[model samples]
Target: MKNTIAERIFDFLKDFPPFDVLTAEQLIIIARNVKVIYLPKDKFVFKIEEEIHDHFYVVKDGAIGIFRKEDQVLVDECDEGDIFGLRAMIRKGNYILSAKAIEESIVYSISSLLLEEIIQTNTEANKFLIASFATNTRNPYANDNKGTLFANVKSLQKNESSLTEVQSAQYSKNPITCQLKTSIQQAALIMSTKHVGSIVITENQKPIGIITDKDLRLHIATGRFSIDDPVESIMSSPVITYPENISVAEAQIAMLQHKITHLCITKDGTANSVLTGILSEHDIVAIRGNNPSALIKEVKRAKTAETLQHIRKKVQQLLQGYVEQHIPISYISKVISAINEAITQRAILLSLEEMNTPPPVKFSWLALGSQGRKEQLLITDQDNALVFENPPKEQFDVTKAYFLSLSEKVTQKLNTIGFEFCPADMMASNPRWCLSLDEWKNQFHSWITKPDKDKILLSMIFFDYEMIYGDKNLVDEMSESIFGSIGSYKIFLNFMGLNALKNPPPLSFFRQFLVEHSGEHKDQFDIKARAIMPLVDAARLLILSNNLKGFNSTIARYKKLAEVEPQNKDLYESCINAFRVLLRFRTQQGLKNNTSGRFIDLKSLSKADRLKLKGCFKPIKDIQELIKVRFSLSHML
Candidate 1:
């Protein structure tokens, strides 16, 4: 009997792993007994605890879900070229997982009897089986316990999955090691051969100390010691050792704690245990790619503004990937905020290097408006302030002039990086914003105590100011001043609360969006100012009343408010959830249209999106009710 279809199956199988290692003739022989099968969506190929079949299945098309027995949790989805059900078959055990077709699918099953026969004689195939089996033991696809794996597999092939948060970090398992008795020359020679900067010194395979190139240069090359010195003479003893399972963050912390660049990983997480590997700060950093800290380091290391510009572009690319991967919008915002703050700091650092004289005293750099709130998603206007420590009477004018010039350069660079200077000139470059810490306190004191309509409007915007870069003491001093002033002026929060309720959610009497009465956006609703800012401003006002100083973000303020006041928990939780949805919607709209996303077309949204938007209004209404009662704004109205 000629197995024509089995021969075709063998041809496809020979091109992929494990099977690829099998000889052409060996593969064709196994293929003769292969089972060609098809499954419809939701049809089970095998159930949990079922006895193992003689054959293992390989997906030919569509997808098959391998679900955990409990709660029917999907562990992995096997699509084309993916193999499953083999481990149970080869081990002669009952199936621990259930496999069902996620979509109508076709598969080919290869007999384990034939697999064992071919693998025994074929060394390459045997080795491939061992490696594949080892990987399966680790449960590489465990995180996708309930997720559709097919959605991620296509991107995996393109290497785009590496940018995703779900991707696992790759770490070194086999570390460079040497005996403590080895001469510095021998260790240095080994390092040079291996192209490594650091080597671990061990005793009976237990990590004892570490020696890096820096030590050799500082101790040996400077004529202080000879090249024949034992590696222990210059070795940094009592080396830091972390578990072999250390996360990227743990590795970073270990590096900082020891003030050393390398960490030894051991079997049981102690210096007495056998060394399994070394995790260099460089290694951790390489795998920590796309994080906020890494991006900042890249910006600092950048020799040219053009290089910084390129890193900024990568930041945007990372942001897009985060959004597409469905990372929580709040988390995405924090990471981007950190990157933005780092960029500003790097710009400041570079500008200081360019300046002839250093800043005279401690100062605070404030990001005013949306950026101050850490809510600036797109590159919007540059709204910032610089508050310096009060200068002596003699140096006042000279110090002020010098800092102002520095602010101008920093602002210009920020403008180049896409943050447009505020049209109203609300920047540190403006003399009004750049002031002494005492002056800023006095400025806020006047606004809070007096509180005219204009002053109230200014206070509402300025009160959320976040310190982007500067001396911590200066920012802390400013916050203390604001809180102190507010203590004497309890009415300020009432006024601020009244101001927040002014916009009224932008919904008309018929539950339809109310477009602007007149302006460039006359026919379009102002989502930012009307729907978003009012809620953000209200959250800040409410939280500040409870003596919260640093709560800048709207959602975070509401969350904190919920924690302190349990009676308002539901309302605050609703606001946080609503804000997340709105933010997600705005970012999606902005990405699609390449605009500010402040004005969303009501007609453009789907029925489900519109329904979700409507759902958000319930919290908006409830919060406004609380504000009206607490502020006595009903009398004001």
Candidate 2:
């Protein structure tokens, strides 16, 4: 007899991992025993501490969020072709985390018997499963045990490795140590001679206290303690200690939890045992090459635009590694943005030094568009503006001229450092963008009161303004001016809503990508204009209408929206996830082809890649509908 349902399940499973490696006979056998289950939004598939089910689940459609029981924080979100509830089944233990439907979802549950008999015996499939366990469990050590079958599973193709998180942290074996009775002066001498930031105080080879550069600055330099005083007077007692076998993640967590920068590696992972080595924050940063803190420090020390340019290249390499390693896009974006901001800040300082004299008045430099939102991953065109304190009517020209000259120098330095000048001349160097505080308020008022196509476009970019240098109060005042104008006019948000819907979801009736019909990107997909911008625009409009402030990035805005409007939390969360996927997809594509990643050739995508791209469009369409109804954009459109 024909088992059509089983055949359908087999078809879907064959496209995903583990099952993808399974033979036709083996997959069909597992699929035959699969049972389909449907869940509405917020419904629980299994609760924490529940007995392990006979089966584990694979998502067929929609999303499932795995939540930690204590905090209810969503740890991992499983989507199409994603497997869940399997870790408990594999361990034969009760569920440690709860699985809930994030939206209307269909999941296929396969018996543990089939998993043990068919999939577990296969080497490739077993490796993939172990990798999945490592990722979903958030356990850095799961794949680190060399004696376990899971060891080296990170080498599997397309598997997300914990990378530095799981690797055994390298510590300085020859730690600089001082006796508990050593004077502060002698300890300081030892630290300087060894070129180390800290020194541990030990008794019988066991760490009892630690002193760092911070201690010297606070205790001796501040005249709080004499340099001749014993180290015990200033040393922080009960030194934080870790095992020699500690992983980077464990060391980092211990540091954060204890509020310390150095960890004493001991023989038995306790301060009671012999101190074997020392691990500092700098060591961890060194392990993760292109670390944000190290990059920022380099940026500060950089003397020329050329030096900054070199650092920016390192930033690109870091981004590539993060993309390939499957790091969370949110974390990657923050790190990259911080480095970019530091570079920009350094550029401004260099430009200021070249000026004939100090600025005549206080001013703020604003980063517009993607940089403003802290979402820039690639070195793209610079969008910036400058706002100085309102000048005296008699001295307006002189004040404006001084800032314009300064702006010109800053923009040139930035361009030299690889941020190409904005093609449209929407830069601080342009007189139109270099304005007084009052002038900027009036400019914003004009755009908000009389909404038009060009103004809407400018608003989309300029409204996400973030101050890179100068008075944050000025930016805060500017924000107030913008909201005040919107509150008065009330129709600007509706206009913004209409603009957000201009680029419909990048899918057609047949569920195929809608590629560009003409132009330089003819027959290619515009991921940015079609997919990314819609989500960005929607978040901006919704957040602006709510009169909220300080939420800049699309992800941050959506997260805030989810918190404020819990009724629509699912929709907002979906938007957040979809935006992340689209952003990561664009960045990966950009890194691959060395272009802006806006246009993608459909032919180059694999079946799995295409499906992943398609998954993002649903949230885009749903959010557009919500905007249309909420802002009454239906009639306006």
Candidate 3:
């Protein structure tokens, strides 16, 4: 007998996971046995400590929130085709969470017997189940798990290789060594001859201590110890040691934790063992070619903007590799950001050398917009400002002139290094942007208090300010002042919230993408404006409302938001996952097209690619709704 309801259920289930992996006959059999249940808003499908149901549920429509018992925090939200109540059923225990309909919901309840009978047999289905059990969410792109449950499953198995983090570090097997009785002068000559920074002090092939260029500078050069003195007189005692098979990650952590540059690799994993080799920070940097330390070293050594430009080009290539390799976006962003900061610091140093005199007052170089957020992957226009300490009124004009001249030099250097000048003249070279700390505070206060369209736009960009160079105190003071202004006029957040909602996720009622109707990007999607900024704006507003400071990246803010708002952990986690996907997608697009990945051609995407892109939209919509309610923006809008 043909069953229309069962067919409909199967249709919906086929597009989703676990069921998607099942055979048609297998899904049909399970769908026919499914019991359809209706739930009103706030109605619980199951409560904490209740006996486990015979069947777990799949949401056909509306939303079901799984709440923790102790605090009733919403740990996860199940929407259309989302499965819930399965973990407890699998474990055969009383429910640990209560599943409630946050909105009127229709759910398809499937018996556990059928799950065990059919779904458990399929490998893909099993992987999905495992991910769901582990993360309590359907999406396999959990922050901890880099990709989908099925993503790279075969490639990972076939490769049988480890990432750099886990791969065995390549240490220098032929370590430069000297006897404990060797004179400092002799050891120094050996180091110079070997072109090495450190020499291990050994006895019977066992390392007892070590000395480096720093030791030479502090002891011999400072006249604290004579060059003729024995190396033991200045050698650092009880050298840190690791085994021959130490991984890169372990080596880095050991170095940081001990505050040492060199580690003695031994026959065994302890100091008592015979020294096999040495691993220096430089070795680690060399192993990881696109490493932060290596890039920063190059930046410091850069004599001209042309050299920095070459380094920045390498950064882009590094970024492309990271995206292709599926490295975590957070890790990539931090490394890239550190490199960018180093380049800017070097640029400032070069600029200062060009100036006639040092700045009359202490000042900070601020990176605005994406650079400030540490989320910039592709090269984009330069958005920056300058903030200097307040000088005496009489010295103000002269101080301003000096900084302005310095800003011109720095901005020109950055331009030469491929950070194109912001078309709107938002760079620090602009007199309007280069200001004293008090002037910046006043500027922020005006924007917050007045609240206009242009001001709000400026606020969205400038509020993400981070100091690339100069006095930390100045940036801290500016943050305090901005927050102070916002606190006095709480309504400013509403305007920001409204602006966030302006570019809603680029989807229409028919679920078709809403691409640009007219412009150079006609029929193309502006992923940056429509998808990325909404999340960025919402995160900034929420963080500011909480009076939180120092969270500049959208991902970091969302993580912090999850920490402070446990009830919304699932939502914030979803946002983080969504943002990461979008960011990675944009970066990949940018790299492929050789343009800023802001505009995406809808026609160019494969079905799976489109689905992946569409997957990110839900969190943007959810977060905007949260912001709307939180800030009371609905009425104003």
Tens-digit lDDT track for model 2 on 1-637?
1659988898888877668777888998988888999999899999988998998888888888887643265656677777788778867889988899988999999887887787556887777666656553332333221111222333554433346655688999999999978999999999999999999999999999999999999999999999999999999998888778777655655564475789999996788999999999899887875555567779999999999999999888767766654446787787788789989999999999999899898999999999999899988999999999998899999999999999999999899989999999999999999999999999999999988999989988999889999988888899999999999999889899999999999988888799988998899999999999999999999999888999999999999999999999989988998898888888988888998888999898766678888889989999999999998878877
Poorest lDDT segment (10 consecutive residues) of candidate 2: 142-151
- What is the lDDT of every predicted structure here? 0.75, 0.84, 0.83
What is the TM-score of each predicted model, taking all chains together?
A: 0.64, 0.81, 0.68
Please name the candidate that would achieve the greatest TM-score relative to the true structure.
2
Q: Write the per-residue lDDT of candidate 3 for residues 1-637, one digit (tens) a residue.
A: 2669998888877766567678898898998899999999889899989999999988887668777643255655566566788888878899977899887789999998888878556776666556556533333242112222233221123111224544578999999999999999999999999999999999989999999999999999989999999999999999998878776656755664586889999996567878999999999887786554567779999999999999999888667645544445776787778788888999999999988877898999999999999998888989999999999999999999899999999999999999999999999999999999999999999999999999999999999999999999999999999999999999998888888899887789999988899978999999998889888998998999999999999999999999999999889988887888788888878988999999999888754467777878999889989988888888887
Off by over 4 Å in 1: 1-165, 174-293
Where does candidate 3 have its weakest 10-residue lDDT segment?
A: 152-161
- Residue 357 of model 3 has an lDDT of 79
By lDDT, the candidates rank as: 2, 3, 1
Clashes of each: 0, 0, 0
User: What's the candidate order when arranged by decreasing TM-score?
Assistant: 2, 3, 1
Q: Which ranges of candidate 2 are over 4 A from the true structure?
A: 1-3, 39-56, 66-75, 84-104, 111-123, 126-162, 165-212, 215-220, 223-279
Write the number of the candidate with greater TM-score, choosing between 2 and 3. Answer: 2
Model 1, residue 619: displacement in angstroms? 1.5
Error of 2 at 558 (Å): 1.9
